[model samples]
Target: MSTNDDGIEYVYTRFITRNGKRIYHQKGGLYKFPKRSKKSKS
Candidate 1:
Protein backbone atom coordinates (compact mmCIF):
# COMPACT_ATOMS: atom_id res chain seq x y z
CA MET A 1 0.00 0.00 0.00
CA SER A 2 2.46 2.54 -1.26
CA THR A 3 3.19 4.61 -4.34
CA ASN A 4 6.45 5.71 -5.91
CA ASP A 5 7.23 9.32 -6.85
CA ASP A 6 5.95 8.56 -10.37
CA GLY A 7 2.46 8.02 -8.94
CA ILE A 8 1.75 4.73 -10.72
CA GLU A 9 -1.19 3.50 -8.57
CA TYR A 10 -0.44 0.30 -6.61
CA VAL A 11 -1.47 -1.60 -3.50
CA TYR A 12 -0.39 -4.00 -0.71
CA THR A 13 -3.65 -5.54 0.52
CA ARG A 14 -3.32 -8.09 3.32
CA PHE A 15 -1.10 -9.19 6.13
CA ILE A 16 -0.67 -12.32 8.27
CA THR A 17 0.00 -12.29 12.00
CA ARG A 18 2.95 -14.04 13.58
CA ASN A 19 0.75 -16.52 15.46
CA GLY A 20 -1.07 -17.61 12.26
CA LYS A 21 -3.78 -15.07 11.66
CA ARG A 22 -5.06 -13.29 8.57
CA ILE A 23 -5.22 -9.50 8.78
CA TYR A 24 -7.22 -7.54 6.23
CA HIS A 25 -6.23 -3.97 5.56
CA GLN A 26 -6.84 -1.31 2.94
CA LYS A 27 -4.97 1.90 2.29
CA GLY A 28 -6.23 5.29 1.17
CA GLY A 29 -5.47 7.22 -2.01
CA LEU A 30 -5.60 4.06 -4.07
CA TYR A 31 -7.19 4.27 -7.52
CA LYS A 32 -9.54 1.80 -9.19
CA PHE A 33 -9.07 0.18 -12.59
CA PRO A 34 -9.42 2.55 -15.55
CA LYS A 35 -12.23 2.21 -18.06
CA ARG A 36 -11.74 0.10 -21.17
CA SER A 37 -10.44 1.94 -24.25
CA LYS A 38 -12.87 2.83 -27.02
CA LYS A 39 -12.84 0.36 -29.87
CA SER A 40 -14.59 2.46 -32.50
CA LYS A 41 -13.92 6.11 -33.22
CA SER A 42 -17.27 6.48 -35.06
Candidate 2:
Protein backbone atom coordinates (compact mmCIF):
# COMPACT_ATOMS: atom_id res chain seq x y z
CA MET A 1 0.00 0.00 0.00
CA SER A 2 1.20 3.46 -0.89
CA THR A 3 -0.01 7.00 -1.21
CA ASN A 4 0.74 9.45 -4.00
CA ASP A 5 1.44 13.17 -3.91
CA ASP A 6 -2.18 13.83 -4.83
CA GLY A 7 -3.27 12.29 -1.52
CA ILE A 8 -4.54 9.24 -3.28
CA GLU A 9 -3.82 5.93 -1.63
CA TYR A 10 -3.28 2.64 -3.40
CA VAL A 11 -4.20 -0.65 -1.81
CA TYR A 12 -4.44 -4.26 -2.87
CA THR A 13 -7.23 -6.62 -1.84
CA ARG A 14 -6.55 -10.29 -1.68
CA PHE A 15 -9.07 -12.86 -2.83
CA ILE A 16 -9.12 -16.58 -3.24
CA THR A 17 -10.87 -18.60 -5.90
CA ARG A 18 -12.31 -22.07 -5.85
CA ASN A 19 -9.08 -23.35 -7.32
CA GLY A 20 -7.16 -21.95 -4.38
CA LYS A 21 -5.51 -19.12 -6.19
CA ARG A 22 -4.56 -15.80 -4.73
CA ILE A 23 -5.59 -12.69 -6.62
CA TYR A 24 -4.87 -9.10 -5.81
CA HIS A 25 -7.48 -6.49 -6.56
CA GLN A 26 -6.43 -2.88 -6.80
CA LYS A 27 -8.47 -0.30 -4.94
CA GLY A 28 -8.03 3.46 -4.65
CA GLY A 29 -5.37 4.68 -7.02
CA LEU A 30 -4.58 7.55 -9.36
CA TYR A 31 -7.89 7.20 -11.14
CA LYS A 32 -10.25 7.71 -8.22
CA PHE A 33 -13.91 8.32 -8.78
CA PRO A 34 -15.50 11.44 -7.42
CA LYS A 35 -17.85 11.02 -4.48
CA ARG A 36 -21.17 12.78 -4.36
CA SER A 37 -21.84 15.06 -1.41
CA LYS A 38 -25.27 15.75 -0.09
CA LYS A 39 -26.38 19.37 0.12
CA SER A 40 -28.17 20.76 3.14
CA LYS A 41 -31.14 23.07 2.73
CA SER A 42 -30.60 26.37 4.43
Candidate 3:
Protein backbone atom coordinates (compact mmCIF):
# COMPACT_ATOMS: atom_id res chain seq x y z
CA MET A 1 0.00 0.00 0.00
CA SER A 2 1.18 3.52 -0.78
CA THR A 3 -0.18 7.00 -0.17
CA ASN A 4 0.06 9.45 -3.05
CA ASP A 5 -1.02 13.04 -3.58
CA ASP A 6 -4.21 11.92 -5.34
CA GLY A 7 -5.22 8.89 -3.29
CA ILE A 8 -4.11 5.56 -1.89
CA GLU A 9 -2.74 2.82 -4.11
CA TYR A 10 -2.70 -0.83 -3.14
CA VAL A 11 -1.17 -3.88 -4.76
CA TYR A 12 -2.67 -7.32 -4.30
CA THR A 13 -0.71 -10.53 -4.19
CA ARG A 14 -1.46 -14.17 -4.79
CA PHE A 15 -3.56 -15.85 -2.12
CA ILE A 16 -6.72 -17.91 -1.81
CA THR A 17 -9.59 -16.43 0.14
CA ARG A 18 -11.38 -18.35 2.81
CA ASN A 19 -14.89 -17.70 1.27
CA GLY A 20 -17.00 -15.85 -1.36
CA LYS A 21 -15.21 -17.80 -4.10
CA ARG A 22 -12.39 -15.30 -4.13
CA ILE A 23 -8.76 -15.85 -4.88
CA TYR A 24 -6.10 -13.22 -4.49
CA HIS A 25 -3.31 -14.94 -6.42
CA GLN A 26 -5.49 -15.52 -9.45
CA LYS A 27 -7.08 -12.06 -9.44
CA GLY A 28 -4.14 -9.94 -8.46
CA GLY A 29 -3.93 -6.40 -9.76
CA LEU A 30 -3.01 -2.84 -8.98
CA TYR A 31 -5.95 -0.85 -7.78
CA LYS A 32 -6.67 2.28 -5.86
CA PHE A 33 -8.50 2.21 -2.53
CA PRO A 34 -11.54 4.37 -1.99
CA LYS A 35 -11.39 7.16 0.54
CA ARG A 36 -14.14 7.52 3.11
CA SER A 37 -15.78 10.82 3.77
CA LYS A 38 -15.49 12.10 7.29
CA LYS A 39 -18.69 13.29 8.91
CA SER A 40 -18.61 16.18 11.38
CA LYS A 41 -21.30 16.98 13.87
CA SER A 42 -22.14 20.57 14.18
Candidate 4:
Protein backbone atom coordinates (compact mmCIF):
# COMPACT_ATOMS: atom_id res chain seq x y z
CA MET A 1 0.00 0.00 0.00
CA SER A 2 1.20 3.48 -0.85
CA THR A 3 -0.09 7.00 -0.35
CA ASN A 4 0.40 9.83 -2.77
CA ASP A 5 1.18 13.47 -2.13
CA ASP A 6 -2.09 14.63 -3.70
CA GLY A 7 -4.00 13.23 -0.72
CA ILE A 8 -4.87 10.10 -2.64
CA GLU A 9 -4.04 6.88 -0.98
CA TYR A 10 -4.09 3.51 -2.72
CA VAL A 11 -4.68 0.24 -0.99
CA TYR A 12 -3.70 -2.83 -2.90
CA THR A 13 -2.76 -6.43 -2.28
CA ARG A 14 -0.49 -8.38 -4.55
CA PHE A 15 -1.08 -11.98 -5.50
CA ILE A 16 0.99 -14.29 -7.58
CA THR A 17 -0.46 -17.17 -9.51
CA ARG A 18 1.00 -20.54 -10.23
CA ASN A 19 1.71 -19.33 -13.73
CA GLY A 20 3.92 -16.63 -12.25
CA LYS A 21 1.64 -13.83 -13.28
CA ARG A 22 1.47 -10.85 -11.04
CA ILE A 23 -1.98 -9.74 -10.06
CA TYR A 24 -2.86 -6.57 -8.23
CA HIS A 25 -6.12 -5.60 -6.63
CA GLN A 26 -7.11 -1.94 -6.56
CA LYS A 27 -9.95 -1.52 -4.13
CA GLY A 28 -11.79 1.75 -4.45
CA GLY A 29 -12.09 4.00 -1.46
CA LEU A 30 -11.06 7.45 -0.31
CA TYR A 31 -9.82 6.68 3.14
CA LYS A 32 -7.95 9.16 5.26
CA PHE A 33 -6.07 8.14 8.32
CA PRO A 34 -6.05 10.62 11.12
CA LYS A 35 -2.94 12.74 11.01
CA ARG A 36 -0.47 12.02 13.72
CA SER A 37 -0.02 14.73 16.27
CA LYS A 38 3.22 15.82 17.81
CA LYS A 39 2.28 14.09 21.01
CA SER A 40 1.38 10.79 19.38
CA LYS A 41 3.26 8.30 17.28
CA SER A 42 1.37 6.83 14.38
Candidate number of the best TM-score = 3
TM-score of 3: 0.34
The global C-alpha lDDT for each of the candidates, from Candidate 1 onward, is 0.43, 0.41, 0.52, 0.45
Show model 2 residue runs off by greater than 4 Å: 14-42
TM-scores of all predicted structures: 0.23, 0.30, 0.34, 0.28
Instruction: Give per-residue CA lDDT, model 2, range 1-42, as digits (tens).
Output: 554455454444444233577544555223342223333334
Candidate 1: C-alpha lDDT:
0.43
In Å, residue 38's CA in model 4 sits off its true spot by 12
- Judged by lDDT against the true structure, how good is candidate 4? 0.45
TM-score of 1: 0.23
Structure candidate 2, residue pairs in collision: none
Task: Give a tens-digit lDDT track for model 1, residues 4-42.
Answer: 444343543444334577655554334432224333333
Output the lDDT of residue 25, model 2. 51
Clashing pairs in 4: none
Q: Number of clashing residue pairs in every model? A: 1, 0, 2, 0
Candidate 3 per-residue C-alpha lDDT over 1-42 given as tens digits, one digit per residue, 9 for 90 to 100: 564545454645565345557555656666555434343334
